[model samples]
Structures are given as structure tokens and as C-alpha cells.
Target: MKPIFKLQNRKLIVIFGLFIIAELGIEIGFTFVSARTGFYFVLQFSILMATLFILFLIERSMNRTKQELTKNKQKLQNIFDTLDVAIWSHELSSDTLLITQGIEKLYGYSLEQFYEDKSLWKKVVVPEDMHIIEEREKKLSIGEPITSTYRIVRPDEEHRWILDRGIPIFDAKGNFVDFTSVLFDITHRKESEERYRSLVESLPDMIAVISRGKIDYINPAGFKLVGSSSAAQLIGQPVKAYLPAHVLEQIENEREEKKTFEFMLNRLDGKRIDVEMSAMPILYGGRSAHQVVVRDITQRKKAERTIQFMAYHDSLTELPNRYRFKQHLSRILNSEGDRTVAVMFLDLDRFKIINDTKGHTVGDQLLQKVSQRLQNTVGDEGMVSRQGGDEFIICMEDISKEKAAEVAQRLLDVFTSPIAIDNQEYFVTPSIGIGIYPEDGTDEETLIKHADTAMYLAKERGKNNFQFYSPELLDVSSRKMELEGGLRKALDNQEMILHYQPQVELETGKLVGVEALIRWLHPQNGLIPPAQFIPLAEETGLIVPLGKWVLRQACEQNKAWQDAGFPAIPISVNISVRQMDDEHFLGSVTEALEKTGLAPRYLDLEITESIMQNIERSTDILSRLKELGVRLSMDDFGTGYSSLSYLKHLPIDSIKIDKSFIDDINHPSNQGLMVKSIVDMGRNLNLALIAEGIEKEEQVSFLKRNSCAIGQGYYFSAPVTAEVMRKFLAEGFVSV
Candidate 1:
């Protein structure tokens, strides 16, 4: 059947011969039919028709078979064309190859284009990848199956990547026939890998891949840190070269705990590295491996040490801080044997005056200079520290009480000469206090407290001096602290009250106004004077709040008196130097007036001449108060150091003569004429003059003669409560 299917010419010859035979038969039949019967001719025609129909059926069947074969072959070709992978085959004997149209999709080429030029494969392949293709083909020809990757240049000159896998084919005789290969377009995947490779190469941390206990790959950062010329120089190196036995032990110890370890690594140039390492198990290069990340921590360690130093020392002066000082003192106190240690507390007097007058920049430089002098004075025998602010502490060991005094004197003597700062000379006087261990106190806190108390004693004796701690000074401080505590509780407990003293016109004997004063009534103790706690409030910054409270109550009470149908005499409230300069002073005054609905004209702010210390600030504040329609009076007039130029510039409506000048108005000393001079000055300035502390008619007579009209003292009326003052105002214009 196979031979017959192949016999094309023979089949055609057979068909022609059959047709001739048929023709001869038909002719003979026709000759016979002419002489024979009609039945014989009809039988011969039927036989010829039967033979023709059978031949036509065979031809139609063959044509249908041919069409089916063509359709099936086209279907197979379509399947190959649809595949994403190119299926190709090479016949080594003919040196020809067959490829699916998928090659057109993979390499931008058609089957004809590939076959039309036998050298097309080599021509399209990039020069760099040509050897890879040759090697892959050689492997396939030798019956060695292989998978390779190479780049190709398309017709448009664009480079594309291909993954070619070759499988050898064999005949029944076991001889290599050809090779079948499959190609996949891996351009996108290769491009993605190249991007990631670029990113990995740019990392700053040392990243290394270890496989089979050997260094397999490392990034550029890793190569640089290891002091290698190229990545190849370190590849395949044993891990033991970097991580020694001790380092491995450290890593093992940290594995379960933190997954990180620290070690010093030596570079190829022999420079040691302080680094922290973290490792994770990973599968790399087709095997179990470890990915290690190393970060250099030398700078971090240096920063930590700097922070530690900053914690215990002052940044500005570079002296031991309070914490370090206390620690040192504590160690000295806790010593086994009986040791004589002196803790000296030295504070510079008038420091704030200098600091506020000259800016903080000059103050800071001055402090640095002072610290240098102190360090030079103390040397190594004692530890000196800037406890903070303008205060310094000196710790001396095995020193006698007399030696403590000598050291304190030496500290004071260091500042006798004025030190120049920013081209300005500043004279500093230090008050030093000495406390001896086991004598003044046994512990650190107790000794420190005693030293502070003695420091105050030196300031009292006169600044620029020294004093040893005495038990009596401790008692005084205890009482002072107790008073401060009571004062704080007094405000909250409603134990504070205001008292008003009537001011009267000297000759007319008519009520002018009253001064409101604060008095504390202790629960256990009797009435406490303002002199006892006012200074404490000023020192501790409590005056700001206390002054606000006082001002509020005075305004509200005066309003209440007027509401009760009493005469609306102006009640004066004393404004302190600190309060006048306070940031919230104006706000407090405004709030009090708004809250109490008190008219501003009925309120009078009385200030002492001491406020002239800061003349500009005082003038500004007074002008603002005057704008509110409140009257301003200068109290204790002759007591301050303000010049006549400043006096004329003040916004004061009146001047209150100092009680000191009035007390000795009739004295034989200069006081007799001083009161008259003040009166003349006030009159000349067109300012009203009021004299206070007039206890006698003679004092009143003197003031009246001096042209001073208003007077306030025990002669008029002592300070009384609000209720009493209300009765006094209702009666109207009382005289002493």
C-alpha cells in the first residue's frame, strides 16, 4: 500500500490504460449491437455505467481524504503558532532547521527570515553572547542536554534576552539525529534582576552571603569594608577568616537572645573595625546559607561616651555638675574612719545685677572666667563644682575647721581684683560658707543644708567674707522654712486679711484715701507682720501670685464699700517693683477691674521710689496705668536713688514723703530741713505731696507748715479691717 501511494506516474498511466480499454470495449459493443438484439445493447450500456460510477466514487473519496489531511496539518501549525515558547528543531545531517512562528513572537523574526539566511542565528545574536550560543549548540550536538541564556539584537537594533534549552534527539539505531530546543522570552525577568543587582550593589551596609561555610557573594559595601580590591578576591573565602572562634561563640550566644553580635574585624590593611552584626538563615546559590548584615558602630560608641560625660558635667563651665558633686560628697561621708571634710558653698553676690544689666552673653563669659580661677585656686587637693547659677561648691578632705576657713578666705581673695569681660570690668564678691563633716552634720544632705545656712550668715555678716556653720544658724533657717511653709498654706486656708489706714489732709482733717496692707493671721501664732514673709515671697517668685491676690481683694473691697453707700474715697494699693515689671501684671489689673466692675479713676496704684531702679520699665508701666485713668503716687519719696531728671519724667500724680524724713522732721540733724526741701520740690514740680508716719500733732504741724497737705499715720488712724473702714468712710472725712 505504501508503494502504491508513492506511485504517482504509475497511477496516472493505469487510469489512461483503463480508459482506452473501456473505449475499445464500447466500440466492439456498438458494432455487435448493430447486428444483435436491443436487449444485448441495453445490458452492455448498464455494465459501462456501473464501471463509471465505481470510478467516480473512488475519485471523490480520495479528494475528501486529501482535504481532511490538509485541515489537520493546518490545525497542528496553528497550535504551534499560539504557543508562547518557540519550538525548533535542527537536522544535523542536512544542516537545516525548522522553527515555529512563535520565533516571530520571541525574537521578532519570521520562519522564512530565519531560513532565508543560514547565518541569521549568529547575525542576530549579540557578540558578547555569541560564544554562549556556540557552547550550547556544541553540548547539544554531543548528546549533552543544556539550558543557556543569551542576548540577541533584533531587526530594530533592540537587544532582547532569550533562554534556550536544548534536548538531543536519537534514532532507533542509537545515533544522534538532531536536537530539539525550546526558547522563552526572559527579557523582562533579566531586566528586573539587573535592577535589583544595581540596588544591592548600592547598599551602605556590608551584606554577605555564606554557603557551605564559605563566603559566596558580597556587595560593594562589604568589599570595601573588608579591604578587598574586587569582589572576586573575597569570594569562596572561608567564613572562619572573618568570624574567628570567639566571634562564633559570641554569635551563638546572641542567636536565641537578640540575633545580633558585636566584634572587631580586621581589614586587609590591618585596620580594626568595631561593628554590630545580624545574621539570618537563607537559601542562596541552591543551598542553605546565611545572610549577614554588618554596621560600623565606632561613631555610635563615641557619641555614647560624650553623652555620659555631659550627664555628669556642666556644658557651659565644664565643671562637675550637682549630681557628680553630691555623689562625691556622699562617698566622702560614707568613709569608714572619722574624716574631717569641709563642704564650702560659695555664691557670687550682686551676680544678678551684673547679669541683668550686661546681657547673658557677657554673664556666660564671666562665669567661664570665674570657673577657671576657681579651678586654679583649688588645684587637685579639692573638687570644685558649679552647683548651678552663680553658686559653686568645694569639697575638701582631711581638712580642719581652721583649714576650711583658710580655703574659704582664699576663694574670696581670688575675686578681690575685678575681672574684665567683653571689655567691661565686673567686680564679683563671693560669700563662702564652710561645713565640717561629723561636726556640722554627718550625711551629705545635712552637710549641704548646713553649708547653705552658713552661706547666708556670711552674706549677713557682709558679703566677700566667709563663715563656718553654726547650730544657731540652722535654727534660724528652720524657722524661716517653717514660716515660708505657713505662708503658702495661709493663702489657701483664708488666713490672710487686708487692713486699711486712713490718709487725712493735714490742715483740713478730711479723709483723702487709705492704704491697703496685707496681714497674715496664723492659726497657732498671733498676727504676723508683713516684714516677716514679704521678702521670702519676693525671693521665691511667690510675690507675683500673692500680689495679684492682694490687688484683686483691695479692688473688690473698695467696690463693695462704695456699693454700701460709703463715700468713694480712693483706696491705694501698693505695687511692688517685681509686680510692676511682671508680664501678667497689666492683665491681672484689668481682670480685677472687669470682675469687680470698679471704675478705674477710683483706683490708685501706689509705688515706692525704689521702682526707679529700672527707670525705663517703670516709666512704661506707669504710663500704661495712667492711660487707664488710675492715679499713680510715688511712695517713700525721698528713699530712692532716682535723679531729678528721672523724677520730672515720671507719670506720678503725687509724691508721698518718706516716713524716715518725717519721723525726724523736728530733729536737730538735716531731717528738719529735708522735709521742707521735699515739699518745695513737689510743689515746684506741680505734684501733690503726702507725708506718712505722722505719730504726733507736732509732726502734723511740721508737715502743714511745709505745705504737705495729706498725712497717714497712727495719729489719723491705725490700719483697720474692711468692715471698720466701711464705717469710717460712711461717717465721712474723719480727723485725728
Candidate 2:
């Protein structure tokens, strides 16, 4: 058949037809001359007939070939329309271009629309790919083939990757004129690759692939675990370099069905890590490759160790638990303890006070401080264990009774110096009890019991001390139990009473106020002074309710006196530090005032200086009380270790000098000097000062001359019942 390009010009096809006719005429003449005379006629007839038949066959074959070529061209046009790829053609000579119908669906632009403005192709190509396309096009000008992958922007504002293969079309003169190309849609393939990459990189565990005894590919997760930069750095590296010796053998012998192996691995940073690795051998890139997944177990192992520690040790003090302590004790007794072994039990005194008044946060801090001190005191010579809250046991091996006593003394001395927490200093004392091995009993149980019993004896003898174990001291434990049982019902039984001490104005001899002091009037025990039962009240947290009772009763008494036409004097009441820290403290005070109908100025609250100095939460309560116009006084002032800086800032109306100083007022020049200094400090700071426990007239005279605003002591009268005070007030003052 004829060439396809020849069909483009009808005149050229006509010229080809004429040339074929000319060649056929020459062939016919040559055939006639070559034949013999006898066969000339028949041969000529046959030849003419054959020539005609051949000529008809040639014309029919050409027509059939032309029909087949037209069908192929139609098929190609159909393919260009139906295929997902967009086909584009360009004339390099004229810079003209054409696009298929697929461009409208893919890029929201019709073929005709793109052909109208040939520059649309250049504009639609992504800016980053424009230079690349131009460079490839320049290569095609030098008779080079053009193939490139570029990002194209669709009319719908979508981006896609396209693999464009284009070839130059040359004229008869061998001059490049046009280019035809097929663009295959590669966006789905590119998107699939991106998704695969993200899936591998985002895996929680490390992943690696090895082929031909070398690591060929490792995902981003694997690179991070192996501490390498990229897969290129890892590829071609021997897999045995990172895996353990046993793991390497397992990898080579991967014929077994077992797919998982766990072992250690070395990172690029030269650190060994515990890893659980699973791998499978598979065909990859026409070669055997291993796909590995690894999970790091180092942190998990450390967490297990931490849980083990918590299971056997005290969290507060970081000391050995009783279980471990007992084990150590058994070993010590079995090995080499022929000499006496002392087990001392230490119980911290008034630790509950700090816990109740200052809060558990401060209490915990105080406990840590005490533990540090105990640890330092018993260093290297004994084993200390926390038996439980505020109770500790120290085992001193190879020691006599004398040595035990020495150790106990050393332990007691540790508390003499102050313990500071949160910028505040606290004084804590522990009552230590000692029980000697073999003397107190041979075994651990009996010795521990004896030591604990001795601790009870030490506490009974008064706190801040120590005692040795004895069989007789165990008897006192029964008494303590009985006391604990009775204390719960003491308040309900009405065994409590309040006695009023008159607080008169020092300048005017007039009864300006009365201080309410609580006394336990037990039915069988007679009158129990506050010094005896107040501590019990505080320790049992019965003080919060007890103090409230005292406040309500005291306020009612003052209100009754005022309603009865007696002179209305502000009644002072002592407050426990525990009451100050209660969250509902302000509500309690307001309720008391509203129930009693007593003016706020008619009530006074007496808090110890220690309470003011220790209570950080007191500011809110103090401010609330001042807002109500209630009088606030610091009781037992000189006895507290209050900072002068804080003393100047407290919201108080007055300061009461402690009874201790007043008792020794005349004993030395320094005692008088101390009283004078306090008086001067109070005056300088604009604080009203009251002196208590003034039994002698000389002390009273000294206080008066020093500008003390008030004085209360036996010099006037001891605390009396409320009825006696009402009678005494009506009958006028009774001198002692």
C-alpha cells in the first residue's frame, strides 16, 4: 500500500498512481517480446488477460489496504478518546498545539478551548516543571528523543503526575517540524506510593528489609530505631552487623516455619538494645529478601524494675519495708550474733500535731526531714526500717545494753537542733524504746514486742525522751487502751466545764473582759486541769468540736451578762491551731456570732503565737475576723519562736506575755530586761501588750510602769466558775 503521509495530499497520491501505470505498461511490452512465435498469439492473449487480471488485483489490493489504514486511524482516534491518558500534539515549527477530548474531563477544559490559545499548555504545566519541559524540548531540537515526567495543573485546580513520551516528526528535508506524544495518567500510582511510604514511616515498631545477605531497604521507623540517617546509608550493609550472633544464624537458617526471633541489637550509636524482632524471607525484586519488624523493650524493662522497688520499699522514706527488715534480722541472728542485739522502736512525738494543724503536705516534708536525721544518726551501724506511719525500728547488731543506751542518746540528740521545712523551723522529738536480744527474748517477735512496749513506757514518762525495755512496763499498755476507749465518750458525758479568768483594764481597775479556760470536771476523777486533758483533746482531733463548744458557751455567757444589765465586756476564748486550719472555720465563727446575737466587738479570740507563726492558711481567717471587728490576741507570746518580720505583719490587736516570763520576773536582771524589751517592742510596733501570771505586786508594778495594757494572775484571782464571776462582779472586786 501507499504511505500514510501521501494520503494527506490528494495530488501526491494521484502522482503515485500515474507512476505505477507507467511501470505496468513497460512490464507488458517486455513480456510480449520474450515469448516464441508459435505461442506468441496464445501467450499474448494469456499475457494480456493475466496482465489485466493482475492489474485489477493490484487496484483492488490497494483499495483494500487503504480501507484497512482508514479503519486503524479511526481505531486510534477512538482509543485517544476512550483512554484515561490525555494525548497532545504540537507543531515545533509554528509552535501550534492540539489536545484530545480527555483534557475537558481531566482538567475542566475542552480540546477546542486549549487549541484556541496554544499558550495554555505552558501555563497549565506546574511552575517547577516548566524549565524541565523546556529543557527536554531543546534536546528534541538536536534530534534527541524526548521523555519526561512532570506535574500538570488541571482546569479543575487538581494536580497530577504525567509520564509524557514524545517523538519528533521530520519532513522530507530532514527538518524537525512537529511532535506527537502520549501522556499516561500516573497520579493514582504516585498517590499509592505516597500512601505506602506514610504507612511504613508511621509504624509504631521498627521495620527492615534485607536481600541477598544484605539490608536492602529500611523504612523511616527502622532508621530511627537503628539510629541511622536514611535507607541509602543502610542498604548494602551486612545484616549481621546490627543483629546478635544467634539472631544472625536464625536469619540464615530461615527455612524453618518459625517467623519470629527475639534478641539484642546494636544501634549505629554503639548502644545495645533489647528488641523483639520478627522477620520473614520473601521474594523481592526477583531475589530473596527479609522483612523484619522490631519492638524496643528497654523502657518496659525499667518500668518493671520500678514496680519491683515499690512493692518492697517504703515510698515516703525510701527505707526497707518490714518484710525485708525481718529477712535481714533472721539472717543476722543465724550467722554471727552471739552478743546482745538491740532493736529500738522510735515513735515521733506530736507528729500528729503537724499533720493536723499544718496539713499533710507539711507533715510529709517534716517526715522526710526526720527520716534523713534518723538515717544519718544510725549510719553504717544499724538497719532502719519504717514500721509504718511515724514509727521506725532500728536494729543495732553486736551491742551491749550500755552501747544501746549510747546509741539511744545519740538518736535523741538529733532532735535538739531544729528541722526546717518550707522556710519554717519545727521542733520534733521522738520517744525511743530499746529491747535487747537474748535478754528481752531470743526471737524477733518477742524482741519487737518488748521494744514496742518499752516505747509505751517512754511516752508515759513524758515525750521527747527514751526508755529501756522491761517486763513490768507492759502492764501500762492496758491502761493506755482503757484511756483510749473512755476518751470517745468523755465529751458526751458532760465532764467538761469552763472557768472564767477576769481580764481587767490595767489603767482603770474596771473588768474589761474575761478569758474562758476549759477544765475537765470528771465525775470520779475530780477536777482535771486543762494541762491534763487539753493535749488529749488535741491529739484525738476532738479539739475542733471542743473549741467550738467553748466559743459558743463563752459568747452566750457574755451576751447573757449584757442582757441581764451587767456591764458588757468582751469575752476572750482560746482557739486551737487545729480550728484555724479547718476549711469551714469562717463559717463556724459567723454561725456562733449570729446564734449568740453578740456584737463581734464583744468577742475576743486568743491564739498561741506558735499557731500564728506556723499557719500559712491563717491569713484568710485573720482577715475575715478583722473584717468583723473581733479582737485577736497572740497568747503565750515569748514561748513561741515567731519571726520578728512576721510579728510586724500579723493582723492582731494585742500580745499576751507568757506566764513563764512573769513567774521569773524578779529572779534576775535579765528577766526584767526581757520583759522590758518585749514591752518596748510591742509599743514600737503599736501592739497592745498584756502580762499574765503576775502573782507579786512588784511584777505588776514593773508591768504597769512599762506601759502594759492588761495583767491577769493570782495577784487578782485564780480562774473561777461563771457564777462566781457574776457574783464577784455584782459585789465589786475581792482582793487576794
Best lDDT among the predictions, by candidate number = 1
What lDDT tens digits, residue by residue, belong to model 1 across residues 1-736? 2233545455466567667877787777777676766866786777678668766876676667666666875786687566557877788777768777788887787779888875676688888887898898788767799999999888888898888888998787778888788888889899999997788889888888876667889999998988897899999988777776776655434423436777887788878878888877766767666778888887887788778988999989999999999999998888789779999999998676456434467778889999999999988879999989899999999998887777777888889888887665677889988889888998889888899888888998878898898888867877889998888888899988999999887777778788899998999887988888899888877788888989999999989888988778888988888898789898899999999988998888888767868998889888898888888998877655546788899998998887767876776534457688778889999999888888888888877877788889988888999888876787777655
Candidate 1 — which residues are off by over 4 angstroms?
1-88, 96-147, 152-160, 165-192, 210-216, 223-245, 248-258, 263-274, 286-289, 334-337, 418-425, 481-532, 538-736
For model 2, where is the 10-residue window of minimal lDDT? 1-10
Judged by whole-model lDDT over C-alpha atoms, candidate 2 comes out at 0.79
Q: Taking the tens digit of each residue's C-alpha lDDT, what string does model 2 give over 634-693?
A: 888766545567778878888888776676578642457667877998899899888888
lDDT (0-100) at residue 402 of candidate 1? 83
For candidate 1, give the lDDT of residue 455.
89
**Each model's lDDT:** 0.82, 0.79
Which ranges of candidate 2 are over 4 A from the true structure? Answer: 1-83, 86-127, 130-148, 153-159, 165-182, 188-373, 381-406, 413-430, 434-464, 468-495, 501-513, 535-569, 575-602, 607-630, 634-652, 655-736
* TM-score, one value per model: 0.57, 0.58
> Relative to the unseen true structure, what is the C-alpha lDDT of residue 520 in candidate 1, on a scale of 0 to 100?
88
Instruction: Evaluate model 1: give its TM-score.
Output: 0.57
